[model samples]
Target: MSIKMMPYLILDGNGAEAVAFYVKALGAEVMALQTFGGMPQSPDQPVPDEAKDRVANAQLSIGGAEFMLSDNYPGMAYQLGDQVSVCIITNSKEDSEALFNALADEGTIHMAFQETFWSPGYGIVTDKFGVNFQISTEA
Candidate 1:
């Protein structure tokens, strides 16, 4: 048996916004979204209206890649860190163009997603939520 390692992000109650941003930026598909706010609760502990829509988990896909997100845990700080990032290697020039544009719309492009001397196509951007990403396509 083999196990695949997918990057997981723990947002500070910003999973939904991050997911929406990724959908636009990476053309990522929402594979699944589990929210504590949307689940049935016990009569003793009813789901709070404020938290009902808060995401418990979300799975997003870009091409064959996937990542997970969550907003259920509280008291967690999401300040920028250099611990993790998703490096996306695009499948085609079109994919690279569209995703790079979308990600750059409201985020910082660390290194412009353009042709590099070493690679055919490449770019780097930090999404709106401060998640760093690397995008590239073959020549």
Candidate 2:
């Protein structure tokens, strides 16, 4: 089987909320969303009610690429230094604007999506998860 590197973003503890944000901003289609508290495989694991809905794993598709997101596992200490970000590329003007507007809500919009010499409908933002995203539709 061929292996692929899917972008996995780790959020502090707001993964579910972050996923919702992405849905609006990127117009992403959610393929799967699971939480540690809801996983049958790990039923015995202790989970607080608050973390039950936190994203254990979420699969989303944008710009024809598969992307993944999750929250830090409880009790697993992490510091989350800035290292990488997943970029999304759109194919149409409508798709670009739809995604840009969606993502801009509840998050910081670094740049607004618009047509430019570099590309048509391109913008940048860092979702509430602190994961940077670049949205663009090719010229």
Candidate 3:
């Protein structure tokens, strides 16, 4: 199974600005972008007008490496040093599980391995070295 690792950055609310900056500063290409307002929502979960412009997800490729960015949901607090995570994408479920378990040892499990809308198995963990990781099988 092929595995790819990429850095994911959480921008408090400046994802659009960040994407624009990266495009000019690093010659990055914006691969995809989705806004919070673009997603389907129930009536009870209406999106606020202010958040309509917030980026729900954005992908950029810089120097042949891909990175993801997203604006934090409204009311979500973000701080420096905690805004970055390594995203591990694997093609095999077994590989994803193995990696998740190995990293969970002596580490904190921020999210347990489980099926998610985006992947067959996904989870988050902070390794022994304090590096945050998001492990998942390819969607």
Candidate 4:
């Protein structure tokens, strides 16, 4: 299956800052950014004040390579050195599902394979070795 992989950084309420820093340090260019407050609101899970100003997602490019990052959800625990995850973009829903299920085997499934606004298939999993992965199918 055709696929693309990119690094996803989870910062501790400093994703915007990190994005700016990386832009200058790595000569990256901002591609897109979405803040928590900009996301569609849900009555069941409202966005917290502390997270409203934080980044929900940010995409960048450095030397033609895609880079992405986001802030930890409000009230979520933050641990140093565990901020990075691998994001895999597959060409088909089947490829996304297969990879996610394979990684979730003997591991943890953070989010079961499901459809999302951005893709037909998406999920999050942390493998047995504790390596987190974000799987998504191209739109």
> Best TM-score goes to which candidate?
4
Off by over 4 Å in 4: none
Tell me how candidate 3 scores on lDDT. 0.90
Q: Write the per-residue lDDT of candidate 4 for residues 1-139, one digit (tens) a residue.
A: 9999999999999899999899889999999999999998989989989989999889999989998999999787788988999999999999899999999999998889999877899999999999999999999
Comparing 2 and 4 by lDDT, which wins? Answer: 4
- Candidate 2 lDDT over residue span 1-139, tens digit each: 1123456687878888888999999899999998877765444756777777778768899989888878876666557674245656666778777776787778888678777554777786777767677676756
Compared to the true structure, candidate 2 yields what TM-score? 0.53
* TM-score for predicted model 4 compared with the true structure: 0.93
TM-scores for every predicted model: 0.50, 0.53, 0.83, 0.93
Q: Which residue runs does candidate 3 get wrong by more than 4 Å?
A: 40-51
Candidate 3 collision pairs:
none
lDDT of 1 by residue, 39-106 (tens): 65679967767666778768899998898776744543356564355755555767776777798888
Which residue pairs show backbone clashes in model 4?
none
Segments of candidate 1 deviating more than 4 angstroms:
43-45, 75-139
Q: How far is candidate 3 from the true structure (C-alpha RMSD, Å)?
A: 2.2
Q: List ranges where model 2 is wrong by over 4 Å.
A: 41-44, 82-139
Q: How many residue pairs clash in each candidate?
A: 2, 4, 0, 0
lDDT of each: 0.72, 0.73, 0.90, 0.93
Question: Across residues 21-105, which tens digit of lDDT does each residue of candidate 3 receive?
Answer: 9999999999999999887775987998888899987999988889998898887667788899999999988899999999999
